[model samples]
Target: MEPRWLSQDEQESWLPFAAMLIKLPAALDAQLQRDADITHFEYLVLARLSMIRDRTLRMSELASVVSASLSRLSHVVKRLEQRGWVRRAPCPENGRFTNAILTEAGWEKVVATAPGHVEEVRRLVVDALSESELRQLREISSRVLQRIDPDAGTW
Candidate 1:
């Protein structure tokens, strides 16, 4: 068997793609930590929970939303729990499952942090692209995500 290799065009595209993957998260995290005292991942977890009617999600579902391991999500939620932003309890419907519930303070934190985060996101990524570019970016992201996790549901 011969080793498969990236062609020149593939290599060229990957360079910038990989760089953006590295740089974008760092930039987003810096803004989040400085303004909201939360990392981007934590913000994502909170944001996802906030959009639900109950502001709560089963722990396993949350791990999927954040694309995190169960262990990692548990650790992060514990930190949020200590801050009085979220609580973990056994699901009443199914004691086998744990639920992560956003507290009043967590909702307030999301409300406070969202506007600034939105502005920064627009300034950094959305504003830099045209309408067509935005659509193209979405398509590109979806294609890559499908390749990575075919069983994944919409987030």
Candidate 2:
């Protein structure tokens, strides 16, 4: 079968998007590293846990939420544990599965880090877009995500 290729207009659209995929993570990581002494992914793991009701989640579920592998999450969690920011234990409901729980320190870390992080996000993304462009970006990203994985739910 012949492969379908991007047309000129499609290529023009995709190039900037592709560059953003490369640049944005580095930019966010840089800010997080400089301000909080954490990587963006680490901050994400902490922030996501903070958002949950109990500040706990099963390892597998947390991995899915962060789009990470269990091994990677476990390693990060280990580092967090060393910092007294997170803890891990067998889930009470199912002993076979482990749960990651944010400690008081972890919550505090998120609280302290969030303002700077939010400011960076706002300055880089939100402030750069008009309201209409923001809506369009959201819609376009959602559509792309749906196409990539129809079963995936919003975060």
TM-score of each: 0.93, 0.92
Compared with the true structure, what per-residue lDDT tens digits does model 1 show for residues 1-37? 9998999999999999999999999999999999999
Instruction: Give the per-residue lDDT digits (tens) of candidate 2, residues 13-117.
Output: 899999999999899999999999998999999999999999999989999999899999999999999999999999878789999999999999999999999
Best TM-score among the predictions, by candidate number: 1
Off by over 4 Å in 1: 153-155
Runs with alpha carbons beyond 4 Å of true place in candidate 2: 1-3
lDDT of 2: 0.95
Indicate the TM-score of model 2. 0.92
Per-candidate clash tally: 0, 0
- 119, model 1: CA deviation in Å? 1.0
State in Å the error of residue 55, model 1: 0.8
Overall local distance difference test of candidate 1:
0.95
Q: What is the C-alpha lDDT of each candidate?
A: 0.95, 0.95
